[model samples]
Target: MLRSKLTDSPLLKVSRPVSACSRCRSAKVKCDNKLPACTACEKAGREKECTAANDQFARGKERSYVAALELRIEKLERRLGYARSMKDSVALNGPDEPPAGDPNRKDSMAFIRAAIHRKAVQTQEDADINTLVSDFGYLAVNTTTRDFEPSESNMTFARLVLAASTNEPVPTPRTADLPAESTARALVQFYETNVIPIYPVFPGTLLHALVSDLYQQHRRQIRSSEYWLFWMVLAISSASQSRSRRDEHYQHAVEFVGRALPHADRALRPGYGTQVQSLLLLTQYSMLDPAHFDSWHPIGFTCRAVVDQGLHQDPPHIQQMGQDALNERRRTFYCTYALDRAISMVHARAFSFYDEAVCVALPSPFQASSTLSGSTTAKRSPDASLPLFRLRQLQSEWYQALYQGNPNEHLPDITSFIWQKYREMWEWSERLPPDMPAAIREMLELELRYSYVYCIASNARGAQVSAYGKLLIFDHVISYVDRIYDIAKLAENAAVYTYHDALRVLFMGSQFVAVLQEIGDLILSGSSIPSPAPGKVLPPPRPVRLDRGTGDDLDRSVRCLERVKLTLRLYGDRWESALSCLKNFEGLSAEVWKNLTTRQAMRNPAPTGQWLPIPGA
Candidate 1:
């Protein structure tokens, strides 16, 4: 019978047994391993579908499991709701039952009572908000007040903004929590509004009070570099506004900068730090007018001392301190230069002796040392280079100005002084160390050229009366132009050939042409040559050369020639004047650029109807 039943049954043999549902495993219930309809799943009304086995869950039982979980969650939520209602009820009244053995029952009861009081306060706060809205609802206008003074309001606003920006709490009169900037701003505002108006009536007392307030408040609080800069600027403004208060501001500035100098020196990093020092020094210098200062000599001496000290220190030491000693040297040079200029002004009677006396008080170390001690030796010290150069220039200018006229006409004196200084400068140039850098040598040469031209101009007026003087001045002017042309030929760097340098050369050439014209006029006056018609002093005819090689070279040459041409036409219209000046320059230019083909072509004449190339082309 078993064999017959097996033959009638349609069953497939399995290699492995199937797994049961995870839910059944957890519930400890048996499962039927059926492909589509498992016995236990069908009895429970769960669809029997074969799903890929997941290690995390049994197959096809997720939905029923989720439903069962939801029912339990609902029951838990219901219980939580009941518990909360009980808590609210207990809070509204007293505890439903007394604690059996709680030791802190009294404290717990007090805490509950406190909580209830806090809630009552919150309710009152809400009620106040409603009342405020209702009370103010009837007012339709919303406008800011204009009755307040603008300056006072601006200061208040600035203070408030500054406080807010810095995250500092607003200040209260009783708390003394205000920031220094706010206090300073308030003081400044008070002075501007209440004190400045009556400044004419009681300037001294009011100004003193303002200064004191600023010193006590803002000045003390200034710790940053920018703050020091701002303080200096303010001091300058204060000094400018009131002449009587100038000394006070000046003293304040000097002290403030003295203190700030160490910081400024420390702040000098490689690039920007050095620039910062320069700016600070310039600011300090700008504060005192040379004309007004009692003595600039002392300032010069102090500056020289500072520079000497810095230079004496090791580079490593300065580097460690984040300072650029080179820049410090430059600053000292400028200070000395300014002092020398002031002294010249005094000597010339351009400024008062009292003002000049101030400079005399500086220590001898600050003064130019006469002896070539090791420390003062020009060759040994690099710092001495610029100052030495400047001193020479200043001296040359003074003498040149003196030779030009009475050493009293301010402008002429200055010009003559520059010329004398130029002569000395050339003498000094000849003595420069053989090892000097080419750049420095080039600069010295340029300065010498400048002085020479000025010297010629200085002697032009005197040259008009005497044949010897005229001949000497004319020769010197021509020689100076030739010297510049030689230097331009030797310049190997673009910096030496800059447009400004070119312009300077051209200007010197024009001045030479002017002097030549003056000489010609003097000749005309002395000789019995009949004068030409009015406004018709025709320049002497001479061959004109217009072919410069490249556009730029051509342009520069033409520009220089044009200046001579214009000056001759305007002053002496005789073609002879233009011809003489042009011939001299053209000859010098040819000698300088003999190898250049363009230069040779430029020396030749251009075709008719073709204009000369413009300058700076």
Candidate 2:
């Protein structure tokens, strides 16, 4: 009688389908693919979370995920078109009879529908490409950039939809509450190695002192606002180094930031060492996160803090403080200056700290021991920061003259200044210690070359230069491209490549190379030729290699682009900009590839419209 009752159960009578919902499939459980939610999800009390993977399948053909998305996109596009037509009709033929629906409402809905469809397509494409390239080990799937300037009503609606669509709450990191000494030490080491060389905000001795205090449970020191700021700094710095642990570290950093924000007003008080240091760290962290892409805001606030403390000006009341205080003030001012220039360049904004107003000199070389404090006055330290700062100043000067120059006329007055700066950069490179690691040397060289490229590119845009100047600029640009390719290849080895390395330069260089390739393709296909201005010398045609084993210049250009893409993929986890730039490069490459291939197919037409494989194929 019990066997009969068990056999009669409806659950036993019905058989589950072979295919399952994504969640149930992953969990190795059976699923009933009900619309909107599955039975497995209902049983597990996760009905809302259930999502079928039907999009990965197709009827009457091999399943193509991209194809499925295309079908949905087409449907949405038609619906949006119909909605727009209705909206236009309502606007033009303002209803004689009361309308059934609001025209404005209809238009907004249509706009949002179309925008969401487009976003979905883009997201799917990015995911496909990211998955394809994941074997390279570091490329990230692109997400929508939230930083675009919106003006259209439809755009606002789209943004609203985008924000509303992602309702999942961000999980607060558990690591934030724990002060793991081993983790702290590892992060400190990462910060010192990868971050500090370029942006040396913390002195070694001071950092050591802080870490020691934190560990010793010295509540008197650790309870202060300074400790929180320092902790946040370490969190962000460590986060920047590790791709796998980045999100966790970032969450920890965010928690520390929350704790520290309440003390901002107090910290920003005049001559507060902890306040200035915290601001600097926060500014550096901002550059890594796309959510806070505008580094200028924080850096501006820091500059104001610096001014309030009179760090820009040499301390007039010199005898009151110790040597260490004076040195720190100088260091802080320069650090702010460097960051100000970087942010200005990135955002194309004006610098908050002007060079002429700065009277304080570079800081003396920092010593690791507390006992090594001495009055080193005007003696410039051999620290890399001093030379690096000088290089940045030169870059700033070139940027001002080139980027900020009048577009209508060529600024020849700064030509001599440009050469002088280049010469100085070259001399500095030569002076770099021969014992320097090959990777570091390459990094510095890339920096110098990028500056050179910028100088020429800017000058090329001006109307004042003669044809000869244009030719010279072209030559210099080509040289920069060649060097960029070399450096990009060098970055492939993970042992030498670091998250802290400059990716912006590589992105810019890739773009420049892509443009050149487009030109080469057109020229090769006889669609375009170099059109020089009056009395200008046309650039010589790029040499075609007789050795077919080594592919043409266009192929080489593509290879260079690939190298940059690979580097971006590796570093994207740590820096949002890296991933964002990767998306752009990939898009550009696809367009270029399509254009080139289309031109090639046209050149070699199929006989009578039916295709046949050529001898090469």
Predict model 1's lDDT versus the native.
0.36
Model 1, 1-617: lDDT tens digits are: 32222222312111012334444555556544443444556677765442212223323322322233345556556655665565565554433434334536766664565456445544554444333323221221111111111232332211211111121121222222322554334333332322122111112243335445545634454333444333333333333222222345444434433333333322321123233333333323332322222222233223323332332223443345433334434334444444444333323222111111122111112211121211212221122244343544454344434442343344533333333454455557667657544444555555554554444344423432334333333434444444444444432332222222333444566554454445544432344333222222221111122333534433333444444334323222211223344455555444222323344356665688887553223
Backbone collision tally, model 2: 2
- What would the per-residue lDDT of candidate 2 be over residues 541-565, giving only the tens digit for each residue? 3322323554544454444455566
* Clashes per candidate (backbone, < 3 Å): 32, 2
Worst 10 contiguous positions by lDDT, candidate 1: 140-149
- Collision pairs in model 2: 138-569, 410-464
Candidate with the greatest TM-score versus the true structure:
2
The list of candidate 2 runs beyond 4 A from truth reads: 1-176, 221-223, 244-271, 316-323, 367-382, 405-410, 413-417, 437-439, 459-507, 510-552, 586-617
TM-score, candidate 2, is 0.57
